[model samples]
Target: MMLDRSITNTLWQLQDANSRQVLALVQKFELPEIVARILVTRGINVENASDFLYPLIKSLLPDPFSLLDMDKAVDRIILAITNNEKIAIFGDYDVDGATSAALIHRYLKEIGINSTIYIPDRIDEGYGLNTAALLKLKKQEVGLCISVDCGTIAYQPIDDAKSFGLDIIVVDHHISMESLPNAVAVINPNRFDENFPYNNLAAVGVSFLLIVAFNKILREKGFFISKKEPNLFDLLDLVALGTVCDVMQITGLNRALVSQGLKVMSARKNVGLRILFDNLRILEKPSVAHLGFSIGPCINAGGRVGEASLGARLLSTCNEEEAYQIALKLINFNNARKVLENEALSEALLQVEQSVTLNTKFIMVSGNWHQGIIGIIASRLKEQSHLPTIVISLNNGIGKASCRSVPGIDIGAAVLSAKFMDLIIEGGGHSMAAGFSIKDHKIRDLHDFFAERFADFVKEKMIKVDGIITVKSVNLSLWNQLRRLEPFGVGHPEPRFIIQGVRIINPEIIGTNHIKCLITDGNTTARAIAFRSVNTKLSSAIMQSGVKTILGRISVNYWNGREFVQFVIEDLMT
Candidate 1:
C-alpha cells in the first residue's frame, strides 16, 4: 500500500500493477511487456491497443458537425466564399492563435479568397476581441470575422460586432462559462451545452475542424468540381505546431493529428517553417520536443515582444522572399525575448526570496518587470518552486500579471472569479496558466484569498516513477518501445523510468546549470544529463554516492546517420 508523501522530503515509489492483463496484451499483440505496461497505464485495453499506438487520422478524426453550431459556422464561411465577401480573421498573440488563423487564412487563399488578418497587441490591446477592433473591421467593410484561440469570453465585443452588422464565428477551445457570447456561431468542444468527445483540443485543432466542416459543405455544393480540391491533410503541420505549443493533451484525435502533422512538417512544405528548420540546423525529423521547445518559442517571441502580426504573417504568407525575411526577424525577436526574460526573472526570484512569511500557497512577485517577459518568468518560477506563481509588472497605478500553476489548481478560474467580483480590472486564462490586471490596493486581498483557497492542497507533492529497469535494458530496443508513445504533453505525459544501483563517473557541470555524467550498472554505460541542477542535491549525490538510483526519460540521438540511446536524468536518490 502507498501512503501520501510529505511535502518537505520527496518520496520515490515504484509504479507496479497486476501483470495478468499486461501479459495477455503482450501475447495477443506480440509486443514487449514493457510497452504493454505503458499502454495499460494510459488506459489502453486490448480493444484499442494498436489504434492507440499507431493512430490514423481517418480512424481517430471525429465528424466536425458533432460540435455545437459547427454547421452554422461552416454555412457563414460558404456564403462569404460564394459571394466574394471580404472576410477578416482575428487571432490571439500566442502560437495557438497564430497557427489557428494561419490555417484558415491559407485555406481561404487557396480557394481564391483573400482575408485580412488581425492580431491584438499583448501589452496595449491585451487578449480577445475589443470593441474598437470590431468597429475598425466594420470600417474596412469586412462582412464576416472569425476569431480563433480567443473571443469565447468577449460577450460585449461580440454583441458590438452584431450591432455593426458583422457576422462573427468563434472557433476556440477554451472552457466556456455558463453562457456564450452572441456570435453568429461558436464551435467549441468545451462549451457548457456541448457534448463533443474530445474537449482538450488546442484552439488550432478546433480551427482545423471548422475547416473540415467548411470543405465538406463546399464539396457537396460542387465547389471543387472544376478545380482540384485543396488537400486538408496538408494543413496538419500548423495544427501540430499549435497543439504542441499550446500544450494540449496528446491523445485520441490529437495523437493522430500530431503524428501525421509531424510527417507533413518534416517534408519542409511550408517555406517559413522550412527556413526555421534550416536555420536551426536540425537534421532529424521534427519531434514533439522540437516543436515545443525550439519552434514554438521562436514563433511566440514574435507575439511577446516583437511585432504582433509577424507570426501570423510568417505562417500564412506563400511568398518565398517574404517568408525568409519574416523567419529571420522572428529569430531575432526570440533572442531579444530571452534577454528580457532573464532580466525580469532575476528580479522576480529576489522577490520570491524576500517573501518567506507570506501566508499564501502561491508565489506572487511584483516589480518593474517588462510586461512582455512576465509570463515566461512566471512559468520558470512555477517550475522551480513547484507552486503556482504570478509575476506582475506594475505600470502607473495598475498591475498586469501573468500566472502559471501546477496540477490540481485552477488559476484561471481563480483569476476569472476575481474579475467577476470586481477585485481585478480584467483577466482570463486556462487551468495551467492565466493573466490579469489588478489595482495596487487589492493586492493584499488577492493574497489572502489565494491562501485560503490553496492552503489545504499545498502538501500534495510527490514525484511519480513509472517503472524500474536495469541499465543494460536501456538500449535500442527500449528506445523503440518508448518511441511508440509519441507526442507526449499535458494529460498524456512523457514517462519517466528509474534505474537502480547505478554508479556515476566523470560528473561535470555543463551549459548554464546543467550537469552531465556517465553512469554504469556494471554491464552497460550511458550518458545522462540533469538540467538546471548544478548546485542542487542531485549534483552532490551523483558525485559523492557509492551507488544511486536515478529517474529519467530515454531519448535517441542520431549523428551522421548513426543512432544511440541517451538518458535524460530528471531526479536522483542516494
Candidate 2:
C-alpha cells in the first residue's frame, strides 16, 4: 500500500521484493533478513549475489582493448614515452578532470617521464580545448597532448591543433557526436560507434584503462625489465575520488574500482591525500561518503574559486610540505565557495518563490552570480523545487548556465538539443546535469525552447521505502549488515526505510538548516537528524508533537571516539 503524499510532497511506498527470493538469499548466503530483502529489491539474484556483495577489481576489470580506439591511444602514449617526447595533459577544472590528469601524470612520473599538467581556468578558458590554449601548448614544444574529462566535441580546437603539427589524444567519457575529433585517438566508451559493454565510466576510469593497456604493452616489450614496474593499484585512490565526485553509476566495473580504491585510500599511500586527510582530522577510514563530501568538494573548490590546477597539483605532488600547503589552500577555498554558494542559493530561492509558477516545468534564474558557484546553486534549487533547474551567471550580454535535473528528465540531452537548435552557444553533459552558454538576448528564446520541449514533463514525486522497521531495530547489527552495500551513489543509492509509530522529542535547529532531535518508538529511542529542512514543511511536521512516521536512511555517526546509529531523516508523514 502507498501512503498519501507526505509533508515533503512525495508519496511513500514500500519497494516490491519477493518474500521467497529474500528467504532464499538469507538461507543460501546466511545473510540478515533485512539485507536479503534489500538485495532482492535491487534485482540481485542468488547467482550474482556474491559478486554484488564483494566486487573485486581483478575479477571485474574489463579488457582494455574492449574500448574502441584504446589500442591507438595506448600505442600513441607508448610512443611518446619511448621517444621521451614532451607531453602536456589538458584537463577539465573539476574533480573528475583533476583526478584523471593526476592519475596519468603519476603513472608517467613513475615511468621516469615528466609531463606538464594544464587545467584551464574556469573564467579565462570556458571549457574543453580552446584554440588559444592548444596553440600555447604547441608553442611550449609539447609534442603529444592528451585531453581528459573533456574534448569529446572539440572539433575546432582539435582540428587547429592538428593543423599546427600537434598530436592530440582525447581520453574522455562525455557523449560523442557522429564525427570524431581530429586526434590520434578518441578513446571514449560513449562513442556512437563503440560497443563497449559498460559506458557509465568517469573520465578518470577511462584514463586508468589507458595506463593499464600501456603498462601491459610495456611489460610485453621488456621495457619494465630494466626498471621497476609501476603498481597500477596505487592509483585506484584517484580513480575512486574522481568516480564518486563525478556521480557515475557505482555498478559492475565501477563498483570494483571504487570498492578497491577505498581500501587504497585507507592506506594513505598517496602523500597528498595523506596530508590532506591529516589536515582535515579525518582519523577514520575513508568511505565513499568521505570522498564525495569531504575530499571532492575541497578538490573542486580550487576550480571554483581558487587556482584551477591546485587539485591536480596536490594529487600528483610528491612533496609532503607542498601537499600540506595545497590542502590548506583547498580547504580555505572550499569554505569561501560555501559562503558564495549559500548567498547565491538564497537569491535563487527568493526568485523561485517570487516568480516561479506551478505551470513551470523547470526553473531558470539568471543574475550577476558567480559562475563558479552557479552549479551548486542549481543543485540546491533543484532539490528545493523538485524540478529541473538552471542557474545562469550573466556577464557582458552572455549567460553561462549550469543545469541540474530530476529523475526521468534528461537535462543534458535537452541542453544539447537547444544547442543544436541554435538557442544556446555550446553545451553537453550526462543525463542528470549539463552546462551551456547563451546570449542574453536569446535567454527568453532558450526558455521558450525548453518550455516547449518539456511541455509534457510531469514530475511524479515518489519515495521508495526499502523496508519498514521500528526504532528498536536501529542497532549495530542492522547497521553492520547495511555496510555490505557500501560505496552507494547515483544508480546505487543507500537504502531508505520507513520508521512508523515514532514521536519526535527535543527537535532543535543544529548548524544552519539541519533539524536535530530524538525519535522514540514507545520503548526505544534513537537520534535523528533532518538535513537542510529549516523553514520547510517537513521541518514543521517534525517539530510538532504526538505520533509520527519518518522515511530515512540509517547511518553510523562517529563522535568522541564512539560510533552511534543515527537515522538520517529524509521525509516525514503527518
Candidate 1: clashing residue pairs, number:
0
Q: After superposition, how far is residue 452 of candidate 1 from its true place, in Å?
A: 2.2
Ten-residue segment with the worst summed lDDT in candidate 2? 173-182
TM-score of model 2 vs. true structure: 0.98
- Predicted candidate 1 versus true structure: per-residue lDDT over 263-369, tens digit per residue: 99988888888888878667788999899988999889988999999999988988888988988999999999988987887788888888854344789889887
Q: Write the per-residue lDDT of candidate 2 for residues 427-464, one digit (tens) a residue.
A: 88888888998899999999888889888999778877
| Per-model RMSD to reference | 2.2, 1.2
Residue pairs clashing in model 1 are none
- Poorest lDDT segment (10 consecutive residues) of candidate 1: 1-10
TM-score of model 1 (CA atoms): 0.95
* Regions more than 4 Å wrong, model 2: none
Top model number, lDDT: 2
